[model samples]
Target: MKNRLKVLRAERDWTQAQLASALDVSRQTINAIEKGKFDPSLPLAFKAARLFKMSIEDIFQDEVSEEI
Candidate 1:
């Protein structure tokens, strides 16, 4: 999955560590999510959506290909 986490964080001028603190996760976890190396759990996603006041769909998307 792809996410708007980096953009959202930047818009708020929040460092990865700051965001991690707010989300109760480690900085590494936020970094991984921003880099698309890890996908957050459902509860985590919900927490993020609530934090950002956006729907989960607004934050994450399927990285589909158009090869077909």
Candidate 2:
């Protein structure tokens, strides 16, 4: 799956560490997510969406292989 965490965070002028702090995760976790080296769990996804005031679909898209 692909995500827009970094872009959204950048739009808000937040550092990776800031985003992680807001989400109660480690900085490395945010960096990993931003780099597409890790995928968040459902709860984390919901938290990110809530923090950005966006819907989950707005930030995350289905894998191309899973798209119709």
Candidate 3:
């Protein structure tokens, strides 16, 4: 999945460690998610969206030619 996580975090001036702590995950997990090397679980995804005050669709989307 494609995500705006890094961009959003940047906008908030948050480091991976801070975001991870807020979301209760490891910094490595936040890094993995931002790098597109991992997709977060459903609950984690919701937590991420909540952290940014956005909807899930506002944070993640498909880059391929598939309907989201």
Candidate 4:
């Protein structure tokens, strides 16, 4: 998935570590998420949405096509 995590973090002047701390995740996890190398679990996604006061759809986007 492609997410606006980096942009959102930048808008708040937050570092990866800071975001990680806020989300109760490792900095590497934040980095991986930002880099699109990893996707967060549903619970984690909800936590992030709550933290950002945005819906999960506003943050993360599904990049895969639905076409079979």
Best by TM-score: 4
Over 1-68, each residue of candidate 1 has an lDDT whose tens digit, in order, gives 89999999999999999999999999999999999999999999999999999999999887873233
- Better candidate number, 2 or 4, judged by lDDT: 4
Q: Which ten residues in a row have the lowest lDDT in candidate 1?
A: 59-68
Error of 3 at 44 (Å): 0.4
- What overall lDDT goes with each candidate model? 0.95, 0.92, 0.93, 0.95
All candidates' TM-scores? 0.92, 0.91, 0.91, 0.93
Question: How high a TM-score does candidate 1 get?
Answer: 0.92
Q: What is the descending TM-score order?
A: 4, 1, 2, 3
Model 2's alpha-carbon lDDT is 0.92
Q: For model 3, which pairs clash?
A: none
Question: lDDT (0-100) at residue 38 of candidate 1?
Answer: 100
lDDT of 4 by residue, 1-68 (tens): 89999999999999999999999999999999999999999999999999999999999998874232
lDDT of 2 at 60: 84
lDDT string for model 2 (12-49, tens) is 99999899999999999999988888999999999999
Cα error, residue 50 of model 4, in Å, equals 0.5
In model 2, what lDDT does residue 11 have? 93
lDDT leaderboard ranking = 1, 4, 3, 2
